[model samples]
Target: MKYAWAAPGAKVVCVVPLGASHDFGIAIDTVMTIAEVDTSPLVKCSVILRFQERPSDCWYAAEAFRPIISQDDDVAMFKAIADRGLAQNGIHVPSSSPEHA
Candidate 1:
């Protein structure tokens, strides 16, 4: 998995993944999951990264989200998603993902 720095205090959607390399900076924070973009509908236990930890806000999107990231590693994860045509969009990686989602 690849990671980008998030600006301190910048709110982001964390994509918590199972059996993946986890982000060491946000391993024990609590976040809220919303079902919709503007709605605050509670979804699941979401974790937020601590601004004090790795405070450099950067959106982690599939290589499709160019200008933000690139598809370098063959197993970059985003590659497979792009292959399936499931390009755009990213999941919030809660601090609990086995690894950086």
Candidate 2:
């Protein structure tokens, strides 16, 4: 699941479990803003929240926040993070993969 399109003025929202609805809760919260579109298209941002269920519910999730980025920047950020993650897990990633091959 990818959400690398939360640009400034972009239409985006969060989904939560129902039944435990809240009367007072922030809907949209943005933590970080990508300054350079050329350097980091998918900038890392987080969301802090105080839920009604548990105190441990205060959590932060990293996101590939994109804001009016170019093709090169988009590809670069994705590829860089992909490479790092794969390499960290001792996995060798090819330049391209086959269709379910």
Candidate 3:
């Protein structure tokens, strides 16, 4: 959930505010850049994101966005799925097996 690693071109899910109904949803966008503004004694940073479906840029706090699945995370998820498939087929997969040395 760390936004520090996010850079330009990185995909992120932005939280959208919904009023009254309290229904909240997320919008996926690509990171444009991080903007820093100096306010006298304080410096504020905002994440600039661009929507994929349209031509628009949104500036929001860094906390409002969450990183999408990373390459390592995808690999681990696929490995888990493969392990489950093997188990379902009566094949044994060691829980602590190393995929690579």
Q: Pick the candidate with the highest lDDT.
A: 3
Over 1-101, each residue of candidate 2 has an lDDT whose tens digit, in order, gives 24455333333233432223564332443233322112234534442222223243443232322234568988999999999999999998766657645
Off by over 4 Å in 3: 18-42, 45-58, 70-72, 77-101
Give the better candidate number (1 or 3) by lDDT.
3
Residue 86, candidate 3: C-alpha displacement in angstroms: 19
Against the correct fold, how does model 3 do in TM-score? 0.36
Q: Candidate 3 residues 1-60, lDDT tens each?
A: 334646655565655441224322234453333333112323264443333433344334
TM-score of each candidate? 0.17, 0.28, 0.36
Give the per-residue Cα lDDT of candidate 2 at 39: 21
| Model 2 pairs in collision | none
Candidate models: Cα lDDT each: 0.32, 0.43, 0.52
Off by over 4 Å in 1: 1-5, 17-101
The pairs that clash in candidate 3 are: none
